[model samples]
Target: MTTKIRMTTPLVEMDGDEMTRIIWKMLKQTLIEPYVDLRTEYYDLGLEHRNETNDEVTVAAAHATRRLGVAVKCATVTPNAQRVEEYKLKEMWKSPNGTIRAILDGTVFRVPILVDCIEPFVRTWKKPITLARHAYGDIYRDVEMYIPGKGRAELVFTDGKGGETRLVVHDFEGSGVLLGMHNLDESIANFARACFRFALDMRQDLWFSTKDTISKKYDHRFKDIFAEIFESEYREKFEASRIEYFYTLIDDAVARAVRSEGGFIWACKNYDGDVMSDMVASAFGSLAMMSSVLVSPDGKYEYEAAHGTVTRHYYEHLKGNPTSTNPMATLFAWTGALRKRGELDGLADLAAFADRLERSSLRTIEEGVMTRDLGILSTHPSKKIVGSEEFLREIRLRLEKSGEAGRSCR
Candidate 1:
């Protein structure tokens, strides 16, 4: 009997919706199940299932991640008004990413999967750039109102010690807008630590950006916290590792990012990260090839692809049309979660199998076998573009050819 890699801990697996959903199953059937004794605490985050469970399944999955230490998630649909009608959903569901991020108090980090054939548009780019996004409260959870006329907005704080503080945020002049936003020092501290720890793990420099020069208190707090944490806890290790952390104005950071070689982690505020990550994904080639992970301050991790559910492809697939959705990032999600689970559980063989799968996937792309998206962007001209399932099959063949099918990860 061929021995399979043993998994000592169950990874909390969150299944998503649509085309990527289809790819998720293929990933397990072809690449993972054949070699590993798979174990997972499965949560169906599919739109229908989320609705059927009143989204309690998502809550349970997040809790499971906290308990289990690792999770692998598929891309899910964040329903819109149209989707509510289409899926007969109970309500316009919130972003699964947002929901889980709030629960775990985590930061979302995005890193692209670089291949030789896939040349980043930026000529100077080489290594992968990771974005550590503070996905917590900021403008994401802000209260906003459209003012009809002149009005005063106040920031109020009641100490409950018989003293109250009130400051005028803005005095609106004819037909304007108002917003209230705040962040906790504790949350900022946690975000800093996660970014620092992640940068150290990747052995790369960490660059934190904010318009600290303008929004002095708000943005400066982020800068101050990162500086304080590094100086007090991580400076020694960072120096020993020859990696550095620097704070800069967001504009200056963007310019530097465009001109410089890519090998560091860019630490961003909630809104900035949301905007810039899309730019980074496109510049690197495609969102379909980017990997993302949510890392909590307490060390819980959830890995996922950095893209959305391919609704267009899913619709086409529903019509029985061939879909060539890129699966690199999704594949990485599984490998990342498995590797972390293996590390935490001392299952070296499981981790090694993940590593092998990753190499095989990359090798397939490098050899000019790719999906339609990559075939269009890849620098190589000698390419054989195939559908999603066919591409995965090609990867599976290469993985089997690696000659370590039954060997221990050790």
Candidate 2:
């Protein structure tokens, strides 16, 4: 930037692990700190530190996000039994994302980072598609069990007023599987509002899908919630904007998405979002090029990459090889956080810097310079493929050029 950006509020910064972690520091050093006096409440969310703090640090970081109202996070590991053995942890810790989403009552939105040089895997896609997932509850928090042969499975709900209601989930004739999941009306309402508001902010049409025909009571509730919120609160605004809120069956949505030119907001429930977001990422580009954020109904934002820590690249790095790891999503995460902070705090310069950073990153790729992953996917005959650090350097140069444009416009 031509001049440093002044910020009124500090952002919650949750750092993470592996190759992305290495890229995180370079992103700030090369792109952010040079032009912005960034103020952040830093929490080391690296796997070892998480184990050391017994994951209290993760909880504290989530709380910090609520307090700060804007957060930028790196991709972190949610350990399993295998990871527990590898890292020597106290316990296989819960996903920091799950914890943060619960605490914030947020909706996760995934948007692909688009570039002209590379075509989407799906030939029909002509624009970007943003997927908003109701991340709070669903199968992620479900109660599941394998049915012993010839057993009855009933969902029991007690109102705490000495009244109980039971719904027969299954009356098994033989050995089978059973699962029960519950979502609160409050959370559903919050998710609806977040998705609708995000559609408004993004200026895109909103499409929500569920298997309500097959799941009248369970899945239908989500469809009902979105319609109720839209009709009650957002219907007028949506009409005024000349944008429509469309609902369809999940199967139909998939088929429509496959054939149609993509440019809209797709609202999905917990499990559908999990599956579709991955499909959407791969269909658009590498997961490393997708940007994700969690937005609370009240407008708190936490930005993160849609992908993992690039464990393979980290291993290669350990062997002293110059790994061509992609860092687009992580860079976008920082920019997203910065832009939210700027917008909320009335710091246009900071917001402009965020814009410039994004444009520069895109420009770098558009100019036929990119990391190997994207370079290989790109149609450019002579794309300059560079290693992770060198790729950041290329984007940094583009960002300086972006700064010049900002200076001239001012």
Candidate 3:
């Protein structure tokens, strides 16, 4: 029997909703607890509970993450009108992720988890591309209004003294909509530093994009900040690391990304990153194979699956049906949190366990045993499709065998 690894600090575990909540329990029981003497400061961010706490639980969880420095979150439900009615909520609660990102002021980094059996749809791609998304302030926090008729829209800023700056947004001939979105210089600088530091750490080229030609004031601010910070703060270190940083228009960046071989980091605004990450995930494979991490400026990290809660699979699970929902991203989320925790606490054995577990999972899929989604995308000749539970059990077997052999991937 293999002794469980001991943890010095507890991980902040945010439990989510629907099918992922089910898988969360299964993962802890099957693959984790049996091997590691796991410790977690747990928070239930499930939709029903969020509504019960009036979303205070989400705020509390974010604070706990800041206090603990590392968190692993399960995918939660972001309620729309339909979800509000389905879950019978008090009001349409805001996204827990949005609330957390706002409090943490973090940047999201998403990268694809590549396996040997699956080839990317993009023929030229030889490696994984990481997308760094500015996780605060865009249309997400915009204020909008419907014009009654023949009205004008203006953006106004007032100094506390007596000075005021006002600019006309639009003049309406007929009824139209007006929107105002804002971002902070502080947030933009943080985003730039995060990207630069990440690039230096990964030793990859950094590319940033904005539609500065059209939105001169707004988008140009982003470009200017990145350039100034790269020149002032990170240029010498980047030169020492032999990494490059460049800026281009978003459209041109997209075209370059599609044509070029993929081993670099692409930085984008909130909306563009939101859209392009999905496109890149699909072009490479499924969103289930993408790992997401939010890194705050102060070095706090939160790991989560890039995809949503498997709602359809949840319904199937309710009917006592075995579902083949992929758990790759969530598994990585756990490993990432564990690895970070181990590193911070100086626990080499714990860190080694995280590495070995990740290798075991990839080895499982590379050997042609996977869940339904990956099974469809995989071109392995001897494919063996399995349900979620069986797939995890297979991983458990590998974990146990690897543990017994005292194998170390690092």
Candidate 4:
């Protein structure tokens, strides 16, 4: 007789497009469905479906995730004007991620894959560096106006209570750039809370960086708010966990990140994260192996592949050709979301399954059975390169062998 296992909660599934969407379906059928009984509520968020639903599907999915507390997503197209014309979209809908993030009120965390054979540009990085980008207002979604002639550009901050006000003036003699950006006190506080939660979750030190020295009044407010939150709310917890929260200037933090060995959580403001995450991705290697997670301040979570739809690879796959697209990140998305779910439910066995799956993936790569991206980085001359399906098969075989070993020990 076989024992039955069940999931306590349903996982919100947002399906996507191109090469990754194809990989996402295959992973579920091959790796996940075989091991666990999942309660999955799926929403078709593919390009055509999104256009058909006018993106209501994405909003509904986000709401479901917020309600269910866990979501696993596949990479989807964030349609631009060109994409709209190419796909013949109805209206250029806002990014599905943007819509969901707005509703969920979360920050996105991106972590790179660290393999033994594929070396990172930052040699000191022994472990993966996870970056949490505060996906709120600053430079992105800002109001801007062109300052014609040499008129003074001023930033005025006014208190909602009384008639108290602060002003910053840019007195220019010639033509120059003038931009105004702002962050709400509420948003910044939530960002700080999320960063601290992520640090606590991962058991890593948290680092926050800003150019407070230059923009003392504006950026300094952010620094001071984060400091106050740390001292008041997180200090005791951080001390107990043996984790530290250090504040540094942006320039200094970048230098240190390059020199220091990786194993810390770095929280960045909106603009900085957008730029820095790309740099980190390049440093690590292929974007194909990068994983992303959205963690709300309220602790709701969603995980997905960080790379895009991989349109080029999808075309090859269309021709019935064996495409060597990397599926590690998508697999990690499932493991990460499930691990968090297991943790929340206090199901150690389920959590162990997630751990085993992750270990199996890494070990498969270590044993020389890998997709093309890592195949190019092969250390052994005898290592034979495999396609995506073949690589997945190799991992499955490794997992089965390990399971047999465990059973034998029992």
Best by TM-score: 3
Q: What lDDT would each prediction earn against the true structure? A: 0.90, 0.88, 0.92, 0.83
Model 2 C-alpha lDDT per residue in residues 265-302, reported as the tens digit of each score: 99999889978988999899888889999988777899
TM-score, cand. 3: 0.95
lDDT per residue as tens, model 1, 295-382: 9988899999988889999999999999899999999999999999888888888888889889888888888889999999877657
Residue pairs in steric clash, candidate 2?
A: none
**lDDT, residue 7, candidate 3:** 97
Pairwise TM-score winner, candidates 2 and 4? 2
Best prediction by lDDT: 3
Q: What is the lDDT of residue 135 in candidate 4?
A: 74
Model 2 spans > 4 angstroms off: 1-3, 144-153, 168-178, 403-410
How far in Å is the alpha carbon of 364 misplaced in model 4? Answer: 1.1
Q: List the candidate 1 regions with Cα displacement exceeding 4 Å.
A: 145-151, 170-178, 403-410
Tell me the spans in candidate 4 whose CA falls farther than 4 Å from its real position: 1-4, 139-182, 201-203, 213-218, 236-243, 404-410
Residues 69-141 of candidate 4 have per-residue lDDT tens digits of: 9999999998888989989999977777767876777788999977666778777888888888887677665
RMSD of each: 3.6, 3.3, 2.6, 4.3
What tens-digit string does per-residue lDDT give for candidate 3 at 131-209? Answer: 9999898877778788989988899999999899999988889998888889999999999999999999999999999
List TM-score per model, in order: 0.92, 0.92, 0.95, 0.85
